[model samples]
Target chain A: MTAVLEVEDLTVRFYTEEGVVTAVDGLSYRIEAGETFGVVGESGAGKSVAALSVLGLIDSPGRIEGGEVRFEGEDLLSMDESELRSVRGDEVGTVFQDARAALNPVYTVGEQIAETIEHHLGYPPSAARDRAIRLLDRVGIADAETRYSDYPHEFSGGMCQRAAIAMALSCDPELIVADEPTTALDVTVEARILDLLAELADEFDVAVQLVTHDLGVIAGTCDRAMVMYAGEAVETAPIEELYYDPKHPYTAGLMSAIPRVGDDDDRLPTIPGTMPDPIDPPPGCRFHPRCPFAEEACTRTDPALVDPETGEAATLDDDRAAACLEYTEGLSGGLDYSVEVAGGTGEHVEKTIDERDEGGPDE
Target chain B: MSLRRFVVRRALSVVPVLFGVSVITFGLFHLTPGDPVSQLVALNPDVSAAEEARLRERWGLSGPVWRQYLAWLSNVLVGDFGRELRTGRAVSGILWRRLPETIVLGVFGWAFAIAIAIPAGIYAAVNKGRLGDVAARVLALSGVSIPNFWLGLLLILVLSLYLGLFPVLPPSRLPLYHPETLRYLLLPGVTIGTAAAASVTRVMRTSMAEELNEEYVTAARARGLPERTVVFKHVLRNSLVSVVTLAATLTAGIVAGSVVVESVFNWPGLGSEFVRAIDRREVNVVMAITLVTAVAVVLANLLADVLYAVLDPRIRYD
Candidate 1:
């Protein structure tokens, strides 16, 4: 399937007075048409920066040091500001984090949305007004006709987010990049918003790139997931494969950290150590210093992703590789050195390493 | 604030304040050491106490001080500001003649200032560290520092003496009431207006620059709105509350600030008339002018509060 959006080896940096701080480093991903692609990472992992970089929205001092971002076969980086602006609201809509600040306080929400319609769709004033009301109703704003005359401050937080969504959808764009769109909302509101977005994406046949830190959200809502660590994509897999058989240790740690409903006695597992600074990353493998399975080789040399043998599609098989040295075959585990017959290739590798380090398992 | 509540609250609040001001101004004029009766007799020499008393009573100075103040305040409340002491003309008639000229100079000056300052501020803010930003900052700094009165004199010397625009002094009995000579008001109008504009522009630029950095503006751009729309529409209006508040106060500032400018050009507005009244110690005229100015300031502030409620919905009367 052809990708609707393709980003390759993207690196973003800010040249501050102190030094250049790398915000996003060599991250790559592809989103196919009509798919919900999720980028999951903790705060400061550069998920929002990557999203902003796609729209050419990064200001001075923060520069796209390297990469190619192509949307429907067009190089977004090569386009001038005017050309880029034409594509921004017309072709790609954005639902920002805070809905309240996103809408202007002075004007009515309908008027603001109508402005977008008029700017992109060339509708006359009266038609634009009608279209704005329709869009607001579609977002579930009640009394759409009379509410059109009300200012933004009159609406509640959830209502403001709805208004923001209405404004975004005014131009009927092909893609929507929502950066933590539901973070500031309560859980009930969050569920409704996600459902609304999923329904809208399906109905409109538009692709979505949802950026969030919630592992459960990505697992439940996204078709595919990409885990970002220290500004790099460590793993990308189908959501089912990612949840049930997470390959990367970081992904495994993330899954173990999720609070299962009835498991109240024991604490949820958490990875130790704060998120590393991106300005000057730890040498060799960026995750080595924090990885529990780190060996001498893991610290001395970086490991590139390799296709795991229990593979799916050819494209996905290559896509699921992890940057861990233990994933390599024959280097640390072999027949003469290995004693126990493990159940699968991945289990065999983990057992052999565990046995070697612990001397022997209990009888 | 509700429209009715706002209007009534503002109207009621200003009444007692103006009454108190009238009393103080009336008392101060009477308390001054020099005797206005002696000054008037000395000037004319043939006038007696009977003539002085007639002049006083004509200007409504015949009653006790408190009674006179109450009478004047009540007259003003009923839209009758009595008559001028020297000319025996209605005060409202005088204001009708001079208020428009003051407003004309003020509006045009403020418009010019907003035009220059907004773009300059945006340019400086957008190009924060570049040469253009530095140039704009320097210009704004100078605008804030330079006195408007001094600038008015400089404009007179440069534009009037060298360029020989209209006469240094505006035409006596300005033909503003007529249509044919309207353009003649341009130079004097510009002189006063530009001085006020320079200060207002600096204010707008500072406010605009600060507001451009707010997260809402960033949010607007992140939504894929054009850069210009984000700056001009989103950030500009949010930032303008301060600018408007400052501009509202300018009605009073320009009136007060225009004293030197008006005197320099002999524009025959209240400011120039005020300087003459003070010098001659025309107690009744001075008290009348002070009362009028105090009312103008109080009314301007009241208008500003209403405009504030209209421009920003977040403010409430409760």
Candidate 2:
């Protein structure tokens, strides 16, 4: 399958009074046509910034320093304002994280959606209004014709998200970048919105770039997942493989942190330390500061993204790649973790590490 | 509540406020150093003591202050604001004659203020941190800092005396729509407008800048709308909600500033008439003008509340 978006060495930086913050450092990923690609990371991991950079929505002080964001083989970075305008809603749409704040409060949701439709699709006002109502109805808004005149505050959080999704789908964009679209929602509503997004993606055959911190969401909705740490992708793999056999220590830590139903562990395992300061990041591997299996080599040398099985540098289309010393056999102190597959293809595996060297009880 | 009900309630609520204002203004003037009777008698030396007493009784100045206030209040309730002591003209008639002029000047000043403020504010906010924004900020600061009367005198000096662009004194007996009348209004209108425009610009700039930072603006831009559309249609519309309140209040302020501006420009408006009446201690005329000004401020606030409801869908009147 052909890729709808090919992001190569994407770098974004923010120039603030404090200093220059490298928000997204040498990030590279791709979304295939008619597939869901997830970018999973903790807060401040630059996931949102990377997504916004794809759409050229980064504001002043935050600059897309370098990289090529080729959408459908067209270089988006080189496009002028007018050209970008034509490509934004017409080709790639974005659904923001906060649904309520994402919608214009003064206008009705119908008017906002219709505005997108009219602008990009060149639909006349009446036709756009009709299309807006139909879109709202398709998104499961009841009595959409009457609700068209209602303002955003009249809708609940879940409803607002649905309306936002409808707006993103207004011009029938080929790709949609949803940044934590369900983070502000409750669990049941999140599920419904996720289901709706998945269904819509299938119906329209659109590529999706789902950015979220929730691994469960990635497991449920995405075909492939890219785990990010400190503005860099630590691992990229198929959903099942990443869940059952994580390669990078950071990815393994993330996988083992999720709570299981039948487990007897009193406390949930957590990755040590927070994200490093972006203004002056640690030298070499960005994750080496918090990584449990870090060696002297990990701190002095940055590892390139490589296929773990083949031990070769991976390209944009690689099926599985991880940036770690163990994959390259350059580590003096090796990762001593073993993955215990729980059961089926979709179940999460537990990573049990030898903790004797770290002062834990010997097992 | 329904819009009609909200409006009626707001209108009904203003009656007590006006009553309190009228009472305070009446008492303050009565209790001040000068006596209206003495001031009038001092001007007319030929009048006998009996004549003075008769005049005092006729004007209801001989009764107890509370009784006099009650008498005046009853007459006002019946739409008889009494007669001016100096001119023997009905106070209501005098107000009716001057009200149009003041309204015209106030409206013109308000329009000028909005015309200058909205664009300047939008420009400053759109080009924040740029040279144009710096210049606009300095202009707004000067506008706010300069006193209206001083600005009026300075304008008259340059535009009237030096440049001969407008008449020093407003042309009398001309209709409001006449070009001559418009030229006459330009100097005073700008003088009063600049003071208010400065404040309006500040408010608009701050509010517009804030709304531009809101997530909806980013969302709108992400939807492929041009920056102009995002700033004007989305950001400006939301920003104007706060600006509406400021604009209405400033419009009322224009009426107040006209009192000083008219004196400097020698323009014939209610402000000048009110100043002259205050100097002569024309209690009836002074009370009438004060009541009118109070009513104007109250009405402007009411209009602001109603506009708030219209502009913000989340605001529901109850």
Candidate 3:
């Protein structure tokens, strides 16, 4: 599949009074045509900043330190203001988290959508108004013709999200970046919104960059997922593989934390500690301080993102890759764990490992 | 609570307010130590006791305070605001003649303030923390700090006295549309407008700065709209709710400033007329002018409420 967007070594920093915050540090990823790529991380992992940097929306004090964000072979980072304007709404539409605030309160939702159409497509007011109504109907808002005149306050939270989605699809953009589109919505509405997003992505043949902190959201909508830790992608793999066979320790910790229906555990397990300060992150592996599988070498060597089976740096085309010392054999003490694979035939294959050798540590 | 009903209710509510204002102003003037008859007699000793008593009877000053207030209130309700004691002219007629002059000055000052404040505010907000913003802050500070009367004196000194760009005293009775009359309006208009513009600029700058940081602004920019579109269409529109409120207050300020400004420029607006009426102890004229000003302040606030509904969709009069 042809890549619609190829982001390489995208770094973003914020010059705050406290110190320089390395928001997105050396992040690299890609989204192919019609694919749904999810970037999942805890808050402050720079998911939103990295996505905004793609559209060149970072304001003052926050700068894109260095990066190559190529959209259809055109370098977006190098584009001037006018050029970026053409790419922003026309080429890549954005759906912000707060749909209510994302819309202008003074203008009708229809007028706002029509404004985008008029600006990018140069459609006349009459034609743009009709197009906006059709777009609104396509996003599942009933009585679109009449609702087009209603202000944003007249729309409910779910309807606002639908309106926002309609707006993003107004110009038939090649890509859509939805930053926590359904976060403000309730659970039932969130499920419907996610389903609608997936349906629209397929229908328009548009690549999507879905940024969220919810792993369940990523699993429900994304075809491939990248797990970011401390502004870096620690693991990226197919959805099923990432969920069932997570390679990195962080990913494993995240998966195990999900509460299954029949489980009777009194307290849910949680990863120890919070995200490190971006201004002064720990040396070597950024996650070493909180990682349960950390070893002496894990504190001394930062592992590169690599194919877990071969121990080599993984390229963009790799289907599965993780960044961990255990994968690269850099850890003197190997990780001791078991794989319980739930087979499709209802059979379970349990592969257990013996304890680490008590001999002197292999340097 | 439709907008029509809401407006009618607000208008109805103004009756008690005006009544309260009229009663207070009338009572304060009457309750003062010196009586109008006594003052008139003292000013002109050639008047005999019979003439003084006749004057008191003519002006209906020989009664209890409440009875006098009720007499005036009844006349006002019937649309005859009584006669000015000093001029023996109908108070309503005097107000009608002077109203336009004050309005002309007030409107010009208001126009000047808005014209200066909106652009200066937008510039300062867009270039926040820059040299332009610094200069705008300093200008606003000076505007708010320096009284309009002082500013009026300075403008007259520099622009009128030194440069001879305008006359020291405006021509007595020229129509407002005449070029000669408009030229006479410049210094006083600028004087009143400058102080208000300074306040408005500061409010606009603050409101614009806050609105620019809103998520909608960021979203608008992300849609590939031009910077000009984002700033003018989205940012400015949102900021107007607050700015409109400040503008209403500035309108009242212009009216108040016109009192001193008109006196200084020798302009024949209601402000100067009101001042002259107060000095002469023409109780009827003073009460009428006070009521007019009270109504003006009330109407300005009403306009602000209406504008609030217009600018913010979430704010319903209902």
- Give all TM-scores, in the order shown: 0.86, 0.94, 0.95
Better of 1 and 3 by TM-score: 3
lDDT tens digits, residues B188-267, model 2?
A: 88888898899999999999999989999989989999898998899988999989988777867787898998888877
Q: Model 2 — interface RMS deviation? A: 0.7
Q: Output the lDDT of residue A262, model 1.
A: 53
For model 1, give the interface RMSD: 1.9
- Report the C-alpha displacement of residue B270, candidate 3, in angstroms: 1.5
Task: State the displacement of the C-alpha of residue A160, model 3, in Å, after optimal TM-score superposition.
Answer: 0.9
DockQ of each: 0.49, 0.84, 0.80
As a whole number from 0 to 100, the lDDT of residue A358 in candidate 3 is 59
Off by over 4 Å in 1: A265-268, A308-318, A328-363, B1-35, B38-64, B77-101, B162-166, B170-174, B177-191, B222-224, B315-318
lDDT per residue as tens, model 1, A1-363: 678888877899999887888989987788888899999988988899999899888877899989889999898998988888788877888888888877778777888888888888889999999999998899999999999988878898888888888777778887888888889899999888888888888888888899999987787689888888888777788887777667677777777677765566576678888787777778767776766655566667665555545432224324565555555632242111222223444343232223355432122
Q: How should the candidates be ordered by lDDT, best one leading?
A: 2, 3, 1
- The runs of at least 3 residues in candidate 3 whose Cα sits more than 4 Å from the true structure, single-residue gaps closed, are A338-363, B1-9, B41-57, B62-66, B171-173
Docking class of 1: acceptable
**lDDT of each prediction vs. the true structure?**
0.75, 0.89, 0.88
Model 2 chain A scores worst on lDDT over the 10 consecutive residues at A354-363
Candidate 3 accuracy as TM-score: 0.95
- Per-residue lDDT tens digits for candidate 1, residues B1-318, read 576787788789988897788778778877776555566667897898799888767667667867877786687667676665456667667666766666665565666667787777677766777899888778777776777777777877887789886567645565556653444455556656654565666676677777776666766675557888888788777777887788777777777865776787666677776788688665555666778778888888888777777767665444
TM-score of 1: 0.86
Q: lDDT per residue, candidate 3, A148-207, as tens digits?
A: 988898999999999988888889899999998988999999999999999999999999
Residue A192 of model 2, lDDT score: 97
